[model samples]
Target: MTTAPVRSRWEEQRSFDELGRPLRDVTFCVVDLETTGGSVGDGDRITEIGAVKVRGGEVIGEFQTLVNPDTAIPAFIAVLTGITNGMVADAPPISSALPAFLEFARGSVLVAHNAGFDVGFLRHFAREQDLPWPDFEVVDTVKLARRVVTRDEAPNHKLSSLARVFRSGTTPNHRALADARATVDVLHGLMERLGSLGVHTLEELQTYSSKVAAAQRRKRHLADRLPHAPGVYLFCDDQSRVLYVGTSKDLRKRVRSYFTASETRSRIGEMVRLASSVTGIECATPLEAEVRELRLIAEHKPSYNRRSRFPEKVTFVKLTREPWPRLSLVKRVLDDDADYLGPFSSRSAAESCLAALHETFPIRQCSDKFGRHPSRSACVLAELGRCLSPCDGSVDSSTYAAVVRQLRDALLRHPDDVVELVNAKMAALAEQERFEEAGVHRDRLASFVRAAARTQRLTSLTRCPEVVATRRDDGGRWCVHVIRHGRLAAAGVIPSGVDARSYVEQLRVSAETVVPSIGPIPAATAEESERILRWLELPGIRLVEVDGEWTCPVRGAGRPHPSTATS
Candidate 1:
């Protein structure tokens, strides 16, 4: 005959151990309390107690008791829990039985179906009887069940219902011990499900289990090898092709989160399942990591990554190179010498920018690819005074060129006049209660402001011959990057207790020639330039070098404060 497995004091005390301990090492007490009535406020009292002590998924001990409540058990509750009043009449009072139950459950994390009900009853009894309540880490099977099992898998998150789904060995019969037994089975099943999602530690299981699906948990192994550092991570499928790319200051934590329910993106679930491995490229700084992520997404065009995937499919609002030079939305930024405003996300946004410009400057709206001469006939825009009639040869070259210069100045240098005009239109429309039209005007102004700010920032960065900035990293080390023309040319780390000047000079000389090529004006895209600018604006970052002037308007559209200008 096999003797019962022994539990050492340390093994039993595993609940108080360091968090993230393996699930198999922690002790759990599955408990259930049968009460005479529905709620404690109604003077209900626990009639029976059932608890099963489990370790490593196997039941090693049990605790069952009956407590005389000093009140008659309600007939319906008596029939429901099948614990008659007579059965508990001769039992020990709660003051005596509560101590015994506490002793049996000590040094274990509590598990129960609808744990709040059981724990609440225990707390009430402990308070009345003047008994101390142990601070037990509780796990609710009901909560775990709702997360791990879907409605189709189980009709509802009830103990009896889940018992049927999991096919618990002991059928629940409204008896405390039997229902508690069923809960033990349910708890084990949920633990098994959680194990697949890399929830090896009790802390991870308790924190993430309710939010993670089984499929997501299954891919937790993919993130196991990632380092906890600032870096870019790539998820790859069986074919070793990149499926998704992302950046994180803590690579391990971020990549691991994708395999949990916390990652609510519909496509991410599929991405996690399809991914077989995760590859990490550590960076000295978060800026370098972000830049690397942008480059990787652009290069791989990963199926799961939505943003920064196809920077080429963006629209640019450009002034035509012809003598007429109407504002045109073009797909590609050619070598032609024309003022370009965009790199906008869509053609509609580019159109909004153009409309905002039109509110101030009367540039042509026609899509004509005109020669040195203009179109023979004036379009409807000319009739509406919307265009300067440049297409109809109504506006001369020098006259149109002056209008083009205004557009350029408003876009790049000073947008105060255009901003004032748009604000007046929005306020006037709002006063007339043409709310929808006002909304359109407001969006146009906002689009112009955002485009103007982005354009100005990008232009400033690209015009600089070279830029060097530094931020303090862990251990007081310095993370440095050398940017040239708004592109991340090179990056390096200056370890603590070392001279940074020599290393900085060396890194700058050997920096890579990564040209900016995404946006129309800059060699880089708006997104890339924005990333560099954001990094430079970080609190500890200091601009160490600048070959060209970088400036912003003191009272222009890009200013942070709202403009109070009139039409």
Candidate 2:
């Protein structure tokens, strides 16, 4: 019989006090298993098992056997382990092989490079045999290899690298028995290097093994299951509260990526903080996903959703922005009677669009002299012929208003019509061989289309002169609640510098001011469900719908806009 190698008394006396620890007696069994393939779910079989048991950090005994597997060995695996289908054909089944191995490992701690994988594969075989497999507490040398070796030098620390790091001499790798013997040497080196600190109680080692093994399984499972279809996902906290909602064109791709270490930073910090479970619903089409995304954002108010809300109710002049700019009413005359062109969230957006009228286009931007004649004389733009010079009394009211109206039409209602008109004229000119003029029209049309699309519309005004208001202080922000016909929705300014009561008063006053008077020179019709806007020069008292969707109608950062930056 080959006797177990005994360590000298000096090995037992050595202690690594530098690292510090509460060292305890432990048994570590370096084990190996030859398998049909590197998978758990696939019906792969284990062909062999070998283990070297160590106590007091010294090799004590060894166990080795070939498992019958009862299935044809895959050719790749047969070559890899040098255990062909014929070799395993007459081998004893796992039912017979497991008992001897369990007797050898009775009080030892199982260990491997990726120890969990080997143990898991064996546990799977145990389940297949319907045999009560003995529980052998375990440890993983793979995790220790990275800790002991310089990271960059051994980034790919597989079994061989770990064995080489410890100078383990055993060879004939991939076979169960030979590798286990190398693991025994590797364990010895690790114990000497770690001294007392490396020795842990069997229970503590089992706990550590379970944690590492579970983490590895979770990662593998997520990679295997993430889907490719476009959809949305909801992340829930441990208690099942909805922590966040996210949408993806490719659902599986998005969910799987969430597990990567790179994704655990900054904004995704929240995902790491609260993700207890992942649940997903697949959308059949991308468009369906978009609409569903919008609805879910509004409904769940996901902490991660980045978009929301329309611009508030306000007047807009869709002026064409340029080196020499054109300004005019894009949709002025839109009061409660019409859907006003915009509550332009940004001034840059409001001025960059063209007017609606087919002809009589000109720069419509003003120098505070708009709605009034120039006190001194025609402005500089008038001198440049960029303006119609109505401010200087150079243009009559009939002509000036006519020009303003034309500007409004060109900017607001018929942007496409003007584009078509311009294109036709350009084509006509081109046919007549006027390339330069056609080019100008083409460029102008492109500018008009780009500008019009960036705009927002004021759809309605809410007059709740008689309804009630509720107040709430959530964390810090002041949320004003308004109940419209038994349904509750939040309103009011999130105030600063002043109290909530004052903010609520300010909200009431603003809402009343924006909607004063019934039919103040109303427009004929509103387009796209928006009411036509005519001036409410007189406040005759008008019935209005619930409003406040567009502009916050309030000032500063506390004001809410749908597309406002994430908090």
Highest lDDT among the candidates is held by which one?
1
Task: Estimate, for each residue in 3-49, the C-alpha lDDT of model 1 and write its tens digit.
Answer: 11112223333332233467888999999999887799888888989
List model 2 lDDT by residue over 107-221, tens digit each.
6668886887898887876787786777766667766555555766566767776677677788647999998888777766655654443333343233332223224224423
Task: Give the CA lDDT, 0 to 100, for residue 518 in model 1.
Answer: 42
Worst 10 residues of 1 by lDDT: 1-10
Give the root-mean-square deviation of each candidate in angstroms.
11.0, 20.4
Q: Where is model 2 more than 4 Å wrong at Cα? A: 1-24, 152-155, 196-567
Query: What C-alpha root-mean-square deviation, in Å, does candidate 2 show against the real structure?
Result: 20.4
